[model samples]
Target chain A: MNISAKQGERFAHAGLALLLLGLLPLALGPYWLNLVGKYLAFSFVAVGIVLAWGYCGILSLGQGVFFGFGGYAMAMFLKLEASAPELPDFMVWSSVEKLPFWWEPYSSLTVTIASIFLVPIPVAFIFAYAIFRKRVSGVYFAIVTIALSMTLVVLNIGQQGETGGANGITDFSTLLGFDIINDAGKVAIYWVEVVLLLTATTLAALLLHSRFGKLLIAVRDREDRVRFSGFDTAMIKAFIFTVSAVLSSVGGAMFALQAGLVTPSLIGAVTSVELVIYAAVGGRLSVVGAVIGALLVGFMKSYLSEHFPEIWLFFLGGMFIFVVWVLPNGLADLFRKILRVKA
Target chain B: MTFRRGNQAPRRKAVIPAAISIEETFVTFGIFVMQLFNGLSLFTILLLMALGLAIVFGLMGVINMAHGEIMAMGAYTTYLTASFIEHHLPGLMGVYLFIAILLAFAVTFAFGYVLERGFIRWFYHRPLDTLLATWGLSLILQQTYRSVFGAQEVSVPLTTWLSGAWEPTETIQLPLNRIFIVALTILVTLGVWYILHKTRWGLRARAVTQNRAMSSAVGIDTNRVDALIFALGSGLAGIAGSVFTMVGSTNPGTGQLYIVDSFIVVVFGGVASLLGTAASSFLIAQMQTALEYLMSGSMAKVAILLLVITVLYFRPNGLFASKVRA
Candidate 1:
């Protein structure tokens, strides 16, 4: 039934999302543009949530883990570039005369850039295969993913020699040998980030409108029925989950470039859950809504905290409760209401 | 676990004038025993927290994500009661500890009652939604605590009676506070077992848990049962918060720190079985302590998490899964 609506809705949503993406870089000032780029990076994870949670009924609270992996993968190369002829700062401080074995490969530009996609995808694929194949899902899957992110954060902090410990990888001067600290570099990274964010959402929209997407919804709603009808439900779930992880990894990578650092805090339970909240608030079922939701929440947080810092948590908490209990569909539903009234 | 026997035994011969074998064995045994004691104390705390979670998630099938914050509510109440005693009723300082535990339970029970009626009850059919909404509720409660108590952690003064330790052997010492917590866990476990098994309310709760429609059709007040059980679970958390003061300190964020571990315990124990939570909490806490001895703290945690994830993959229902129809 939704196959037809999804096809039309996909194009309509993609057009709106792309139009906003097109307008943002031209409309905003440099500071806000850069800020939006960070939020857009977050949208990468939100789009993942829409596909995995919204379409396939698999909620992962470890998107940050994948994001962190992607960012750190990129950071390793950049850190190596910045500190050429020497080991990365933390590794050096931990006191070895020579560079670590793992850090050696990241010195190459090809491996570093390829790792942004290559690293998170295969790791996510294996993880999804293990968990989803065993049919551990729903709240259990969420818990496992959260545990994964929390474990990664702890691992990063513990291996101060390799990953920079508590204070994550930083001091980046170049990406692909371009001076990333300067204005032009920041703008270049920001544009690249926005484009990636749009591309991810576009891909998500297309996936959701496809035949497999319809089957995903069926599996979500009635797993036993779908299984009885002869679907390889596990593979479908694993595929979607891996895709979500891929999207988050891209965001994490861009985030490192834009923010100039990647910290363990980015991959903690709090960050992972916050990403989920973004998707929920944006309208979990809609691809573009998740992206907009991430940006809106980021803006609200920065804006609200600046004016009334004390009240921001209360507001965030209230929004979480309101979105989950009252408006499960989020701002997208509200937009529909407004549009209906205007029509 | 330790591979120091051969070298250490010879060194003991040179260092000690007394029986080297006995002294050496005692020394090694003492360290392991202490870790075991510490692990047990950790287990007691996890059990207290997980018991509440097990009740709500296992029996009720509602994921109350605000559980840790609710536990914090209990801790905060204890902190407040402690302050009030210190300031106003100086004579009752020692006695106030027991009163504070009761107060914490009563206070959070009332809050839980209201919360169940107002929010959680409406979302019983939707477990995942309950999780998100309760998480939001947790944030609100956390901010509320910060606003009220200020951000700094608050520690309640220990009652003189519960402040000391007992040493059965010459080498091994067990703190009174930890023993007190362990005793409290036993008492609560018995109380929960009795409430869910022996009483009329327990029967109704069991009926509701097993088959809500049939039970309701046969004239059970499922709604009241739901509210009371939730309150009971929350009250248990409150008591845990009160006891938490005896062990360490409380902050607005105390509950948040423990909530994840509490969730892990509940899931590890197997949802729908109180016995499962008890067993899993003990296993997890002990494993954590034992691992810390072998590796760095963070790596120990990562290892434990990996182990649990791997275990959950194999036994998806957990260590002691209860048979139930979805």
Candidate 2:
């Protein structure tokens, strides 16, 4: 395809995506709108997965740790706001004499917002660097991430007095004095999420089409060759991992705001792996495809679990096998092939 | 300090009273000894699971995420056998445990063989894809078990001979079941070692693992080797699962509890060495047990995980990794 034709197709695609998202609020009730917002929250993680796992070849099975870091930060702020002048209910129940030092910073909205990136970005960078710097990749790297996520889940559950344990930081109705549970607030949050999602998708697209993205693909295909060419391959891998971490953190913060709670279960190994499937199903190489994948899969899961709870896993698991075996490049590729689009 | 239960309460810095009793000291000693045995039993289970994982990974470079589910298959097989013996072969109750172990191995071995032939062979070169695919298979298997056996946990009833503990000391009652599990692990380990070293198939397996092209050129059916080794590794996991029933109840999700830990054992031991897998499992199990004595169980697990990741940072190939050209 020529440049003008390709650009025209891109515009058409973006226009369709916008129209679809714009129609949801008008077409659906408050309840379904809220659910799509949750799926949009997850798409952020899926986008990050595309960059890190798809481009950089780092299959981190622990993105949930970063997601939780963002989520818990947001939750702490909301909880503190809800229970101002007194400890959060769980803390009081657990007989904590004073608010933990970590919880103090979360009382401020600015600090809480900053913390979504401030904490997880550094941790993600350091963790990814530590492993990639030593040339650990592939299955080993994946397993290490799994262990990391598991550790976080255990630690979060173990520190019930401080972290809200398995029940998580729920029972919060307001965010910055705005009643979040109301339908108006829910619709507002949904639009805000949609705007943010579009912004992230565009930014990710720009990044993936850049020279750095080319280098990332090179590193994925042949890291040793990239290293031999004087590139610090570890730094390259870590950078994208950290970038993906940032996206996941933002998604997680959104998740807390929209979902009304953040729990340890949201950041366990199982959830992390599930996050990867969102990218895999969408087409790991396509930014917008990942968003659609998350929405599609998320909708299927919600609908299936509610209606046919017994067989949802069968469907989900079947999708995984089918994607690996047949639809390796995901739905985007299938669509492209059907349309006879040139790569 | 004299009246304190050893390893139960965390140590405090407060000065101890001088009126200590010898019996109290003996009890503390006994508890410590019991903790060590507990670690041994955990180490055995980890080793069994990791042995199969390491072997499959080393030979074909395929990550079998369903290996844990395969182990669960063994546990369920044991559960089924126990129920069958209870219903039809009541007179053979004493020997049923032994029969179940062999049956579990046979069942999972055949399952592994079919799984590899049907699914795993396609992704031999795509290790990461294999990981995700097998993970999907694991979820499918877990759901299948849940549908068949229900979500509730099932336990294999121990024979009359296996139920009681040995009173090594007045305070230290070592469970007979745990001791039996440890012995079973040792026997299995020796059997695996003997097969790998003495058998012609073992030679062919090692040859293929070391250099597949050469093995193929030398007229060894490398695909057959791949299938057989995969099955054997799965059979080892089956045995591990069978033994697990004596220690804990079997649930559809039981395999998930061990999958991450076994992966750690395989990675921490280095992917290439069987001896490394064993050593790492022993190290991790002991470290976790010791840490649990000093802190909460969850914290202990976190500490071990952090320690393993930290160690991997410096030694990515694992602590005992043999030098390979890659």
Candidate 3:
């Protein structure tokens, strides 16, 4: 099948899958709903990876930096909201007098949401400009981003009073005036996440199908040709990187809202690498593959950690090796191959 | 322009004399000496780590994110050996330092070989995948070590000769460990140079690194070369880890601290060049340490990274990049 036709057929399948997933909360318990919520957040990150890595051929190993940025942004706001007449719990414990200058803007939801997109975009733009402008492609680019993520983690850890360090940002009482502790609030948050996930997926799909997306792909495949055609490859890469960062930030924000905490672990090198794993294991050639990969990995993580925490990492490692060795194109390709065989 | 140039020569001549008071010159010289030694000590540790990373990343184009983990493994090995010596050997603890380092190297080398043969061999062309796979491996290794080693920092007991300091003055005292690392680094560098330039195995390795297909056509076992080179690189990391235990604390997650710095050194040194790697390592370490002494640690890091960025901006191929295709 041609690319568009394949996309159309996959879209139909995805629509059916999402319809079933939306109905899952009604049939399942709160624990399962929360699990699905986690998957949705991961799916958001996966979508970002599809744009940055899958379509653009930029293998960014530090999506976690943006994820952490968004999470920290939302967490800061939530922390402010939870703080009644007094400062937030961590700040109080740390003996901070007034809210720091950087924390001031996050008090407003408008600012937080704006920053959810703005912060990571600028960071991505500046970093991408610095790196891509120098024509640092392939593994060198990956290393630079990995270093950036590590720097963020170290900065976060060092700023213990502001960031809560390894403990991260937690202990949220409310989000947008709704008591998060209540069951109804939890369900509401879950539904909000579901809506956001679908919106992000649709937007990403539309963007990828656009002319700009084709150019991005062309740049990935033949950089010299694209440059000869008078298009600046670095600018295009920076744009895609910025878009990916914004989407990752949105995912991070939703994740912080769902988990009610944000930590350095969210933005660490490990998490960034995990994002790439999801994209690779899901099938980097297609958007749906990323979503499936995220869902499967997230599901496995939640269930396996709960049941057998000790062996969870081992299972994760085994899955990575399995995906790379046995199914290099990821689970999506495996499914396609099986379908082809049956046909 | 001609008039200004003529006028500026006398001003420049006057400024030179004004800039160089005897006490000021002496102070500047003192600072230079201090920074040079600081740079050397920092270079020792960085060279130990970067040498291993350079071989794996440069030769095979495999970004072993878990190189630091291998170093951690070496440190843990040293710690365990020290413990064993403390319990059983008693008086033989000092004598066991050499044995402990050798054992550390052997254990990590074996681990590296198994990892390459089992996992890394398949992902030779896929740098990004190797990164993710190795990162996953690092996590599992870290968690496993945490479970086994009990998460707290383990101290490696140094021999009596490896302890204390060398004093040139009342205020100037250099630790024995730093001197030991410097000596070890020199020996390791010489050993590596000899192997790469002198031996038949090294020739095969170099041939394979340059062109895998051509080397195979010439009857070289490229696969064995890859495995051995990887093992050797990992063994070097293990030695670095063992050396690190003398100056710092060892924990499951200690590897995280050096991984970023090592990568930066590798990149800035021009990936695949040992001489470049060593030069860049010294340059970055000296600049960073000097800046740290002059300013704050974070600020120094920021400054060093900026310097790297500027250097890379001007010379995208790095300071000493090979003329081979990436």
Which one is best on lDDT? 2
DockQ of 3: 0.41
State residue A102's C-alpha deviation in candidate 2, in Å: 0.2
TM-score rank, highest first? 2, 1, 3
Which digits, one per residue and each the tens of the lDDT, describe model 1 over residues A1-343? 2234444455556666656567776787777778888888898899899888887888888889888877888888899888887777788898867777877878887877787787777788888888877888888888777877887788888888878889999898887678887878878888777667767766776677689889989978988788888887888888888888888888888888888899999999889989998999988887878888998999998899999988998998899889988889888767656544222
DockQ of every candidate: 0.75, 0.82, 0.41
TM-score, candidate 2, is: 0.96
Interface RMSD of each: 1.1, 0.7, 2.0
Instruction: Compose the digit string of candidate 3's lDDT tens values, residues A1-343.
Output: 3344455546545763565355687687776676667677877788788788777889887889888888899989999888866777887778888878998898899999998977777778987877788898988888877877877787787677788978999899697788875777767888887777777777777788789989989987888899999999999999988988888888888888878788898998878887777777887766777877887888888789999887887778777767767777787677666555222
lDDT for B114 in candidate 2 is 88
True contacts kept of 3: 0.40
- What lDDT score is found at residue B322 in candidate 3? 86
Provide the DockQ value for model 2: 0.82
Docking class of 1: medium
Q: What is the TM-score of each candidate against the true structure?
A: 0.94, 0.96, 0.89
